[model samples]
Target: MGERGRDRSRGRPLPLGWDEEAVPADLGASTSRPVPGPGGDGEAASAPASHGWSRLSRRSRRLIALGAVLVLVGGLLIALPRLLGAATGPEQVTREFLQAVVDGDLETVRAHTQDARGVSTAALTAEVLTGAEDRLDSFEIRHVAVEAGTATVTAALRTGTESREGTFTLTSSEVGAFSPTVWELAPVALPELQIDLTPGVQEIEIEGVTLPVEDLLMNREEHAPRIAVQLLPGTYDISVPQVTPWTEVPQRALEVPAAFEKSEISVHDLQLVLADDARAEVQRQADAMLEDCAASTSSIPEGCPFAAWGTQEDTPGTWTLTSSPRIESLPIAAFLWTLQGAGTAEFTPAGDAEPIEVPFTVSGTAAISGQGALQVSVPAEDSEHYGYCTDAENGYITGVVVLEEPGQDFSSECA
Candidate 1:
């Protein structure tokens, strides 16, 4: 300690706000001067100067230079490897998956998949083959992000190398988890459906989705996963009794013009079949209906009065099977048509009913039961003159009756 410093201290502590060594050299007078005090020894007294202040001190200068170099090197280091993960990137997996597919080695592809559902890639291959008619050719992996765990594989898919291009998005099961999985396509929406007064789905359309009808799979609702498709409508070649209710729907397979309005349609056709294995029950119902038909004559307003009931002989009748569900599933029902000598009785609308073109559905559904038009008709009349008459004198009776199950054969030619 210097003499002056000891005299000023007087045994108390001298405090400092900061480390003197860290202070900038320009922030104060050079540390080389001597301070003069009372009776001071005038001769300049010097202590050893730190080699850090001398340029000729190779050790200190080199140490500073080396420390600077270390800082630069540390700043440039990349931590990408630590953040992304240690696993292989999605691109490589996809590339290998494609190669395996080309080699027809599904087992290899399955091993590389990151399916979230833990679905076997081999199983996926089988499902695709079954659903797509087994026509797989090739796919090229365009990009893969390990962080995203998603790979975009752009490839020509076909039954052969001459395939077409289809964009597919295959992603891992979760975010930040690189588990590759197969692509799941969205449901091609059906149209806005107005289930008319007929029986089942009267009409359906995709609201904003303008998918072509040709691109749709036919008989969509027939199987497990229902698809929307426009079926060919016409008088089917098969017998009504031999067809499923879905197939038995009587639709005229003509392109519905966009200009056609609902009020412009006038007729609705329908098929009648047991909703399920309930044909026996429907037969009983038919018996009851017959009783009602016989009683409807003069007693009930809706009863059908055909004189001489009780299983009268089969009179001469022409019943062409339109998608016959069975020889006996003849869905030919009777609904009285309204007519007052054509135009003699001015038949004007009586209520708020407007006509419209429509496809129809009725009598249960295709799923749990069956699908088919149990009802179809021209646009309804809003008046009392042109409606279903149940009373023989003034009403149109429209109802359904099961004539037979799927086993009856009405194919016997008339003698």
Candidate 2:
């Protein structure tokens, strides 16, 4: 075979017992004795990956590769450079397509694709190079050759979790450039990965960078001087940070926040109903919720905290005749950990037009030592649209409530 030799891995798994030249020399000889029992030599044994990998026994995985090799090794050398000539036909253009890839220039790579997708090669190049630094450990382009209008090349790449050895091929593109067609969207089965979570101290690893959990959680907005967590139904040991000491939470932990003592909780209602006056209808719903809160609690002027705080005016079925929209349903939560509640928000329109139905919830988690609860919820709308508590029971949001993603707030965005 005049095939170019592939570099063998340092360690390999070929059967040591098999004589390299014996099989062919004894091609027609019958050897094994018919054992009387159930088993013969049995099926071939598998060697661990660490030992070395073997080629797939199935024909499917090797079809494209085998065909490409057969055509190239025939000595009708359609050398890559000439195939990628400045004004070569599409078929001739297949040979040196992988050169652009080895050069790490996406613009040139995109131009070599068989189907340009109507997108500029420069744009395609930009997409491939984006976040590429985060994904690759090492990359090397070995050889480029073309058979017909397709190109094949050998490349070594290190994916973050593991090292993969495979051949890359270029699909013919309508443009002069050939694009790699490796993203066929197969159910890529990766090896199993496991991580253990510690209570107080968080472990963080971003690609090649690793940092502790405390550093990530540290923010002026949440200056958590101390944290205590409780992992329920206790089984695992609590490991606390020494300087920023940590402890594994058991089930429940009484959280004494950095700057606050008693954490307050409540939910706010924003409703919209169809009526003659859409604007008034929305105001009416807001007022009704506020009125109920005031009547229930004795901490408001005229027993109305909203009216006292001017969160909503103490309007009585007031009708403002204007062309505005009627909101459907809106609910938001406000939380305060150290005190009763946060301050207030100045009212603003959701958009240039009318408002739409939106659900809103905010919650917080506090850790006292090793125990902490992730609280989710329907929030109390007295002050801040902040996820400001660490109590699980009070903070956990369930049901029809809309809990925003960890770092987002619907209060202002949804208005």
Candidate 3:
């Protein structure tokens, strides 16, 4: 058979079940086979990759691949509609526009609207819109119509319990032959607002933004300024900030309707009225001054509104207040506030003289001296012959009474 077979036969005997003569002669012979090489010549090949992959049948691998493809296609089918809905449609754009208004997204709303001439964007801010009451709460697309390159979308808008139908017009244009259609909202014209404010207010606060009257006035130096502004449909708060500790103007919150009617908003005589606390403080100070005057025993009290003048030379008298003076009226002026009140004062001259009771009125001027403190000035007694006029309605006394030579017609001198 072969030299290796003859060597194995001479060395050992075959097993019991193995037949030596029946065995093939080429059983132990060595042989060589051709293997592919990089150059495609006959050479030994490198070992193959893992046998696990090689053990898989072609049909099994193809089946697994087909299953994976089906899974991917099913997922795409589920998500395709949502992705398409987000990208293209005029109805989608209309919905987005309404949603942006509800969200107070000024940028998005401006992006959707077409450019208009003379559009005022000063009040077109998210903060202003957000501060408004009865703003757009929700919306639903009711109808959509497309004809030629023009489209109209009607939406049901709701604010609070009020519902209204708002229609939007859109125009589509092809940018180029190969480009897709582009849609934009048509220009909308809204109403204008004309505001007339009072004189004392120099500045106003609307939706957190401070507006000065000088800037808003048609004529820069006008006493009572007017502000003309165009804003989106919303309610706004207009108020004057606290300019002084003694006075304030009431806050006004007005709503600018969505209708196209020209509206005029006027707020006149918003006077710098005295605050409650300031009035109370003024009354307290005035009361204290009168109390000190009543406690004085002299015939003429210095720096006091009331005095017991024309008394006998050697007679001492005491002035007592029967009714305390209260601040009945306070009138405000540029730098001073006038205070007036009416009360009864009793003056009793020495031992045997009867007490004289007079319905006396006091008038004084108060001003803010420094650090918000009040400085009050009242008339005191002096030697003179003068006529005093009494304003019963205003509780003010205007006069000059001079004793020409002590008790020279004291009653005739006062009027």
TM-score of each: 0.25, 0.20, 0.44
Task: List runs of model 2 lying over 4 Å from the truth.
Answer: 1-99, 114-132, 135-154, 159-162, 169-415
Candidate 1, superposed: residue stretches over 4 Å from native = 1-56, 72-76, 79-94, 100-135, 141-153, 168-415
> Residue 387: error of model 2 in Å?
31
lDDT of 1 by residue, 12-70 (tens): 32323222333334434553445454469675655345622542344666677789999
lDDT of 2 by residue, 229-335 (tens): 11111012122222222211122111111110112211111111112342243345444534354343221224322222322443222112122222232222111
Q: Which is better, 2 or 3, measured by lDDT?
A: 3
TM-score quality measure for candidate 2: 0.20
User: Candidate 3 has what TM-score?
Assistant: 0.44
> How close is each model in CA RMSD to the real structure?
20.3, 30.2, 21.4
Best candidate according to lDDT: 3
Candidate 3's residue-wise lDDT over 182-281, tens digit each? 6777754444555655433456667767766555555343344556555555677867666557665557776665432234445554335567776787
Selected candidate, larger TM-score, 1 vs 3 = 3
Clashing pairs in 3: 384-402, 385-402
lDDT of each: 0.30, 0.30, 0.61
lDDT of 1 at 145: 33
